[model samples]
Target chain A: QQPVQSPQAVILREGEDAVINCSSSKALYSVHWYRQKHGEAPVFLMILLKGGEQKGHDKISASFNEKKQQSSLYLTASQLSYSGTYFCPRRRNLEGSTLGRLYFGRGTQLTVWP
Target chain B: EPEVTQTPSHQVTQMGQEVILRCVPISNHLYFYWYRQILGQKVEFLVSFYNNEISEKSEIFDDQFSVERPDGSNFTLKIRSTKLEDSAMYFCASSRQGYTEAFFGQGTRLTVV
Candidate 1:
């Protein structure tokens, strides 16, 4: 099943902050975050495993709450380069299977202006 | 740094024609995948391949769709009969393992006219 992403679109000025949320109805074993620029492939940002882990890189961070079946991506002091679509893909815990094929959300279009 | 590479960045094919999108995954990666995204839409998984066989495939991967790892370094997705709705950006991705982070290629923009 596809995850639901909040704030279908967001516009922010340089150095501003934004938060994107993703919620899944199924129990997720892992959550992966990616950023895709126009006409480019989706770039891996971070991956959070189950057990309520929080991971960050540079000015971007994410938190996964397995019990709540939700994940939030936080971008701080955003840069112009951060203007792109953010996607949260989830892997469900299927019985007797570990193939880990990701189903992505609708994505949050983020525009960072100078 | 290793990366997945795709060929024919953009392709236009007539409806009902056959088209094959190619990819070369990073050396030593064990898993390969194909995904597609319509314009301004979310990416959707088509199929996953491992050990030269399909491990999983979504409903979108119907009878007309097939994947092949014909050679040691090349992976390909073939659409037997293209349809107008098949126009989309096709991406090839690979991961070191089944549950690891995946790296995607630039993608092939397939336009079925």
Candidate 2:
């Protein structure tokens, strides 16, 4: 199932902060965050694993709550380059070999103006 | 930096025709996947492939759709018969492992008329 993202859109000025949240109805083993500009493929941002393992961009931060099946991305002191849509793709904690696919949320559109 | 590359950045095909989108994932990656997004919609998974075989697929990957890793470096998604609804941006992604973050290609914008 697709995850749910809150605050469908957000507009912020440079140096401002913004928080994007994602929640899944089913058990998730990991949640991946990505950023996509207009007419572009999604770019990998970060990945939050179930047991606290994290990887990806050094500047961006995110947290995953296993018990709640939720994740949130934090963008502090945002820049004009941060203007894009954020998507959270999740992997289910299923015991099958076909666990290669990821289900992405609707995405949160963020616009940062200087 | 290693990155996935997709061909023909954009493709326009007629309804009921065949369309093939090609991708070359990062070297040494073991998992490959195909996803699509209609204009103004969420990205949807179509299929996943590993070890030269399909590992998982979504309902959207119907009989009209097929995937192939024809050579050592190329992966392809073929739509046997395209419909108007098949028009969308098709993205190819790959990961070092199934549990890792996948890198997406630039994507091929498929337009069916």
Question: Could you say which candidate leads in DockQ?
Answer: 2
Name the regions of candidate 2 deviating beyond 4 angstroms.
Answer: A51-58, A93-98
TM-score of each: 0.94, 0.93
For A40-91, candidate 2 gives per-residue lDDT tens digits of 9999998887745544354568888878888888888898999999999777
Q: Candidate 2, which CAPRI tier?
A: medium
Clashing residue pairs in candidate 2 are none
Per-residue C-alpha lDDT of model 2 across residues B50-74, encoded as one tens digit per residue: 9889989999999999999999999
Candidate 1, superposed: residue stretches over 4 Å from native: A93-98
Q: Write one digit per residue (lDDT tens) for candidate 1, span A8-97.
A: 999999999999999989877778899999889999999887648999989999999989899999999999999999988876534334
Candidate 1 residue-wise lDDT, B1-113, digit = tens:
99999998999999999999999999999889999999988899999998888999999999999999999999999999999999999999998878878899999999999
State chain A's TM-score for model 1. 0.92
In model 1, state the lDDT of residue B77.
97
lDDT of 2 at B90: 98
